[model samples]
Target: MKRITSFILLLTLIIAMVFPAPFAFAAVTQSAPTTEVPTTEVVTTEVPTTEVPTTAAPTTEAATTEVATTEVPTTEANTTEAATTEAPMMTTAAPGTTNPDTVTILHTNDMHGRLDAEDGRVIGMAKLKTIKDNVQPTLMFDSGDAFQGLPLSNFSKGADMAKAMNAVGYDAMTVGNHEFDFGYAMAMQYKQLLNFPIISSNVYKDGKSVFAPSTIIEKNGKKFGVIGVTTPETATKTHPNNILGVTFLDPVASVTAEMKKLQGQVDAFIILSHLGIDSTTKLEWRGDNLMNNLASNKDFLNNAIIVLDGHSHSVIENGQLKNTALLAQTGTALANIGKVTFDLQGKNATNITASMIKEADTKDVTQDEAVKAIVETAKANFGKATSEVVFHNPVPLQGERSDVRTRETNLGNAIADAMEAYSETGFDTAGDFAVTNGGGIRASIDGNKDVTVGDIIKVLPFGNTITQIQVKGTDVVAMFEHALSAPTIEKDGQVGLDANGAFLHISKSIKVHYDLTKPAGERVYAIEVLNKQTNKFEPLQLDKTYKVVTNDFLAVGGDGYTMLGGPREEGPSLDTVVRNYFKAADMTAYQSTELQRILAGTASENVPGEVTTETPTTEAPTVEATTETPTTEAPTDEATTETPTTEAPTDEATMVEDTIETVTTEQPTSIQDTPAASVEVKHDNVIPFDQAVKQKDKSQHDAKAQTDKETAHQLPITGEAAGTGAAAIGLFGLGLYLIKRKSA
Candidate 1:
């Protein structure tokens, strides 16, 4: 009997080893003991893989490649993919979709008080609010500089903007330099009006935060920590008196401290930065500097996710920093709005996508009733003076700051001409020249458009009064020297022209030939005064005192021009001065004498002498007219004239033309609620994190690399666990082979 049992066991062992499928099935029914392999567990594993069987092949290949290249475990990728697939299965999903874990952020920056539509493009605040309501889980945020641009907001010292923002339901906003335009008290007043939080980690007064340093917002059970930063340039950029006691801290230090404060408290860290993208390019301390500085302290700032930036009027849809944070900046004047979508699972972001919506494309969008009412009311309040037609422009006027500051522009000439003509009419005396700072002319009139009081207000939004002052020719030289003396900031990697508001835009009565290549005071190579008496051009007399026309802002030492003493006496509102001038003067096509008044040349070589008293000259129109007897003709709302030759003078004119594109502002009779037709993803700008680390500090990178290397070398699982997993896989494969043999 023992011999017969041994033979049977040997025969069974051979059968199990060679063609064991039948035996394996029989063995499973017999249930040997605890050592027997569980067929049910193997089947359960197969069922999970079969659910998304099609994705498995590609996923495995991708996983293998990632592991080989990164030398890191691919478990995170697998977990993220699984979570993304399950996103659609949420119970309390976002409206119209099943993505509860995902949230949308609707953002704008540098709206600059653009309450009304322009060129039928800008959607205005009303439409923005409408769009925000439709996008589920959306948080609306403004990065700052929403004050002090349009007449509707500027006239009220930004109160109107505050009202509109309140109506739009802005979650938060940062402080911008323009916020201090009316002064700190007014800014605080506006802040009080806003329903949303005004936060800035950097700005301080008496060592206390000017506003809330950061705020914690909860949405759908997720905690978000948002910190704000303002530009350090606010010190010199705004009116000196406006921010008297305020101190702007370094953005890097402020952000780092905020990170520490909010470290364990929030799921995400977002920065509302008025610091723009280009620093060296703009010659200002910008977002790039902030990011670079933050990247230096990688250990502390690893949690920062996004930065909503402003201040340079830039458009960056998906700008990334070396610290693995995203940045979005919409262009100024509410021209564009940024949208960021974050898919968070648990406490970490699984995915992030960003894009910008252009206001011009927002034709389909509707205006929210509440916000529409607020905007309409604000416009109506300012409409009496704003809506009346003042003059007409046959050709487009260029009043862009960069153009007017860097060289002579037609809009500058027109404004100066009005000031000079107004000084004569209001004061009964014509000055030798009229000067207005480029910063004062904020907007330009579109060609073939009716110039309205609203248009003039937008251009000269400051409401400065015309001032007639008398200063020595030597002082004139000093003022001009000071005007151009403000050193040029960085522009496109080169120092071109200073962004100083003091850059002067002179009247047609004086011809200034300057060499920007030369140092500040030495830039003025020649100055000629158009003698009203001789009707001829003559060299400026340094010792002789001449009557000068300017705005009260400049006369009172505004923008570092103390040389031009306070206005002799207030003459008329600057907008009114220009309005009255155009009303009386002929509505002829005004062709800008390109490079005639302010000629840019080299100090080594004087501009080709064009001033010649040798030939008889035509009398310049008398700017001196008694205030009682207005000299201007009847003003027409819809005035048109024949187009004149618009060609520039010479090669020099070509250079200016190529450098500065003409800027024109077109106003529609009514504001339109333009909505974006579609959105286009501007490709991602991924900062090479490792390369950035290396560039920042070799020692830091080396230290980080050594740690990473050590971590990577360590096994993700214990040897026993890995061996058990391998043994299970081997047994499963062997079972499959035996089953196939038995079937054959």
Candidate 2:
């Protein structure tokens, strides 16, 4: 039996070796099934041995299954972590397509009703249109003063200016001081004609908004907020009646309020300020000056990203203000255009660049046909009156000066002469002289040149009608005294006549000489009136009232001539007189004499001869022998050796002969005719009570004073306040940190 069992075990071992543990069990089952034995009986016999074998199978299967599960979980966990880290990065990297980083803003300031270019250095509406067409998605804005410089603007009462601007597609504009030239009603009418928005943050009427406080434009997904601030000084500089019911608020305060309101709403902020730059420091700061106060106000400086300045006619390169904000001015008369570019994101500005639109670069640019048509139509309606040259002048004339109303210019003299001539010819009474305020002349005429109608208009741009007035010589002297006494006319602490007296250009026949060293009121040394008929010079008689010719500006006492406005007798219009003079003097005979000849006079026996003469001789005989000579007897003693001698005439007979000769010699008269009438003018010198009050108020609110006050207040209390706050915060934070650290 033992031998048989061993042999059987050996066979089993061989089977196990050949089949492996898993197949050995499957083979046993197959073998059992073929024999028809119960599978349960076979499994029961092999259970303990099978369990041992399955233990190894379970270990291997468990290891393989654990590896597969671990791989899947690790891969899924890694994928989830990666997705969580990358999502925020993608969101951060993409700026929405609608972001406004590509917006451009184009602006102009102080166009001053210049529909056409002036001096060949300016850009007109046509050129402006070309620029607009070339720049896409551009918003055009005028800072202010778009009207009131030329005849075209004045005759149409700003209608033509508005139409021209509209034709060029202006997007927005602001009101300037000159807009009130014709009065607020006219300004309102002009506003009505504009197709674009008009913004004036400070100007108000009857507590109602005459114009919007600000304008918002959305272009290229970018929002631009623009606010306008007219200088408060307008109240004094412009006619008070025009702004009678209006009140001008502080520009800094107005802008600050507007900016706060616009925050989070616009991507960029712009301020159109008609406030001129300060003359003293050239820095933007708050001071008594209107422009200084506006510029220096912290609120405005901080809030505005760009300031398009006007009135002062300044140009800024690189667009920097306080090294923070961007600022620009295109000067006056369409000389240049201002351009600003901004990169914006939603309501925030990221980058900015600014440059001036130069006239040279755009000179040949095509003009807008629409604006051109409007200009042409206006011209056609006005006829030659708008374009004709009034007369020709040999010298240039200009009216601008630092402080004084008078300027030294040949043109000024010519204008005064023309006025005087006109008054004399047109008026019934003998006009003593024609006088004009130096400020009346706006430009210089090139001497001896054909003065086109355009040149005449430029020189007399105010379009003031001439008016005749009668004043005594005393009153004329008083006007001169007032001009000299005015504090504004002084320079360098010394008040005296200019070397050229260019500011006081006067006509012929009236002579004025003043002492340089004399006090303001006593400067007039002498005044002479010329008798045109007899060609005689005579001193002015203070007691006698004389008729004078002057423009309506002076007759109404414009430019601070109080004397003229006070009880001045009325006469004919200066325009009528001038027209009459031109009529009397054949237009064909109108010839411009040398400035020197007009200033001096023709040479005479008593005067030096022509400069071109080769030789000069004295015509008056030398007075060697004053006494009459006695007759000498020709050695009458003929018998004694008579000497021949001539007898001199007796004193009585010589006197009679001299008297007869003097009587026979008549004064030389020239063919040139003199006008009959004389006109005297006085300027308005009285400042209205309201204007004085406003000036006082402005002085009190000087930016320098406000800044000083702020500095003083801060110096005393800021340190203490900061110390207390810092101590309290420090204690609280210390307590919290101690508690947290202790807990940790």
Q: Write down the TM-score for model 1.
A: 0.64
lDDT of 1 by residue, 1-744 (tens): 544554555555555445523222221123556743211100011111111111001121121121121121122212111221011111122243356678688888878777765545466888887777776544668888886676776656677789888877777888887776665566777667887778776665543456766777776666777788887655544544455555565465566666666767777767898877542223224676555554455443444477788876666656554544667777677767788887766556645677877766788787788877877887777775467676667777776555655555677777787788766656746677899887677766787888777787667765556778889887887777777675544444544554445678887677665657777775665567767675566667777888998876566455556566533856645766777666665434245343446655554443233444432222223343433212221111101121011000000000011111111111112211111101111111211212232246667778899987676445254434445445545665655566555557
lDDT of 2 by residue, 1-744 (tens): 544554555555455444433222221112333533111100010111111110001121122122222111122111111221111110112222334465566888767567775435668877787887777434678888787665555556668889988887777787776676555666777757887777776565544445666777765555667777775544433333345555555455455556666666666677777765533111222111333333454443433367777764555545654423566666666777778876655544546677878777785687787888887876665444544444544333433322113322344444566666655434555467767665444444454666554444444444344556778777877765654442222444533332111124455556554444545565554455666564544556777776776655445433334466433433332322332333233232223222311121211111211111111121111112112211211110111011011110000000010001111122112211112112221211211112333357668879778876566534432333445544545555555555555557
Evaluated at residue 79, the lDDT of candidate 2 is 15
- In candidate 2, clashing pairs total 51
Lowest-lDDT window of 10 residues in candidate 1? 646-655
lDDT of each: 0.58, 0.48
